[model samples]
Target: MRGCLLDAGYTPDGVRALLGRSAHDALTRGEPEPAARASRDGDELGTLVRLFLLEDTEPEPAVTAALGDLDPLLAGRILRRTPEGIRAALDVRPYGEGPGDDGEPGADWWVVSDLDSPASRQDREHVTGVGGASLSLAAATVRRPVGSLLDLGTGCGVQALHGSRHAVNVVATDVLPRALALARLSCGLSGVDVDLREGPWFAPVEGERFDQIVSNPPFVPGPERVDYVYRDSGLAGDAALASLLGGLADRLNPGGIAQLLGSWLHVRGEDWPDRVRSWLPDGVDAWVLQREVVDPAMHVGTWQRDAGLVPSSPAARGQAAAWLDWMAAERVEGVGFGFLMLRRTDSTPTVVVEDLPGELGEGLAREMTGWLDRIDWLRAHERDADLLGATLLIAPETVLESASSVDPDGGWSELSTTVRRWGGPGWEHPVDGPAAALLAGCRGHLPLSELVALLSYAHDVPADALVAAALPAVREFVRHGLLLPVDGWPHPVAHRVAAADPAGPVG
Candidate 1:
């Protein structure tokens, strides 16, 4: 492979810079190249290269000619670019010099996307990169300091770059050499130290555990992927994702967690949450924040275009129709997409499997890690201690005041509608009345028990009776957001739905 890379104009110095001594040793050892006998499932480079050969639909001549330029010593990768410059690299790439700003090692190479307009060969969908899924997942990552980090399916290396800022060491892996190069470039640009490895999910780092792991894996099942091919696993609905999730618990260290972004296929009559839940490993705390679901029609349209299938061409027009047919035939209700944050631990983790694409996911991801940091048994209850202590102060503008007098005749007076707050006054009931009498006594100063006792005593009633009577007012206060519990109380139904997705609207 190195010889092939050299033929492609890569240099030995380039190879040494990224692979280091171990990689060189593997390439030089008399032992069968781990990349050869190893399949896509292997942690060795053999598996990564095998996956490349298996997955590539590229013509043999192009691949063979590309490989002819062998330079085991130099960094080399193959990238296919559109005449317009838009490139989506396919091979495991070699590194070049680091970005001038810092001495960080250079990137592995490949072209998954070229600057060519979206109109170039096939999928007409807009191309997205670190700016979208990668960045979103990065922003949602747990900030706790960790000793080492793993970026599975590192792609352009965005997740690895994010991890570099926190972890002492970073391992970024991918099946594509081109992707490795791009990741290297990204690391170079960020001036971060990252060890680039070419292998599938836990492979290259076999037997190694990290305090943190983050991935924006190629979870977009074969169906709804971007035409970039680089982004999709090219596997059916959830196979790839299952492999990732099913395999994660073993890779994570105890107390360590992995944060990921992914796309899932929801089958009819099959509970999507349950399907995802089935993938969680025992004792691994998990949170699956489903952000959106696109119906068959939308999914088909979205993915066909992504594959560069032009709706205008007769062939593309048929392709689009076929996609729609396939989805409907499968009764594909929608494609579920979300972020999964998992931690390996002894405690039963609260797994929030939801269908949310709106503000809820953003808010949940932002706060959940902190919530996880503080809670012991997330699965045991939805209630958190912090929530139990939380206070909800009513806004001044929304607070209502009261002025009332009981009818002297002991008859109900006309119920008038008027909103008022406390006038500039002291501890008076504001207007002597049962409601006011009860309200004025509630000074955050009194313990609930004591306050109830006071109310009972003032009313000359049994404490139990007083509590029963005062409950309505308390309920009203809750309605007005005047008070709130700080405890993270468990919800009877563990699953909660998230907001609507902005793009793939679900019924």
Candidate 2:
């Protein structure tokens, strides 16, 4: 079956080239007319695309010619014979990436899941294929080689397929047996080996730990009711995500990392970061990035549309009212969705939660790893004296930008100065003139203590006062990759730094 699909040019790139960019983009938005027109030709690729992707029927002879011996697919209920012709009962889409020019390998495989459409809504157990959340988790996941990995709530096994390329062993779990069956089929089709388990949450993996775990769990915020198995956990509010976060420490080996996509409630008069931080367990470090937040109405509308409910329809309106009422009663002002990266650490847990809205480009895995490494480096030099004695260097991609305006006297005046990173997370930090000058001297040549002393002598300010104010900002810069320690710029080798100069502590 895989060979036949490949021979018929059914890969991701091939399909995009065949459908043309405009039609392919339309097909992704769930509009099939353009794809229907593009795949009108009676070729093998067209037959498969029409039969599977466009949800259109094909003549029996064409189906047979495109896929030899339809008996297996028919028996498996992947296809059905009708009076008009044969129609696809399932969705088998090509999914993968080719090796990159930088010598990084890639994956080439297919994903199998139940057919999806508003016109043909399935039951709660319906499994979905590769989606936005799935792709996001895969992209953000740390791809370093590991001995074992756990794919929690592995719907259709998309993460499991990606994990197989890096991990020596992969275990995937789902609460629904139906989901597990489809996940098994996905692995089989991809020619990858994954241990498929059936149970809810951590039940299937009890008493076991993994080097890494990745999940795009059912994180939709709603009442304690399950309308769809793929998006509902029957847990009130965002408790499903909370439960997952609380149990992560025990399931991860030392230094193990877990990356997940989740949604959390934003209550009135409450900080969202604090609400999420309360869910973390001890002996674990976490970094939460809130990508987006939506009001109650938008949240309800989005999920309702996902469930194939027309916004103007009576049923959708009724459900939306109930969902909104529940949110109002619970005091949920909005819902925030983002990525969570947690690590099992032996030392004190460090949690950084913030709103980072924008495009997170490629190499996210590398950037995330770098962030954690920086955290370790910062934790080592916690004291002011220790950090000041350490040499620092600015990141290569860091840039400084300033804005100026013409004053009434026809003279230019600087308005604001900001330091930003060009790649990875693209974080921006606003800085004052003195702080900017301090960063400019971080060329991996001298200790931060000396830099502060020199700046104090030049400005004629107390060195102690300068050191006191600059240490906090320096830590922030290092934490966010704007500044790097000379000894451990790229990776940390030791936690402790040398003592401050004997002349006297700058502060």
What TM-score, to 2 decimals, does candidate 2 have?
A: 0.91
The digit string of per-residue lDDT tens for model 2 on 1-507 reads: 777887898877778778898888888877889888887773898898888888887899998988899999899888999999999888888887445333556666778888887754436777887777777777677767799999999989888988887789999999989889888877887799999999999999999999999998999999999999999999999999999999999999999999999999999999999999999999988999998999999999988887778889998898888999999999999999999999999998899999874587653565677778788988899888789899998877889999999988888888999999886677888998779889999998899999999999988889988887888899999988788887755333333221111110000
lDDT tens digits, residues 289-402, model 1? 777787766766675565556668797677677667767777777887888888888865556575442253333332455446434422332333322223223223323354
**TM-score leader:** 2
> How many steric overlaps are in each model, in order?
71, 0
Task: Note the Cα lDDT for every prediction shown.
Answer: 0.54, 0.84
lDDT score, candidate 2 = 0.84
**Model 2 misses residue 310 by how many Å?**
0.6
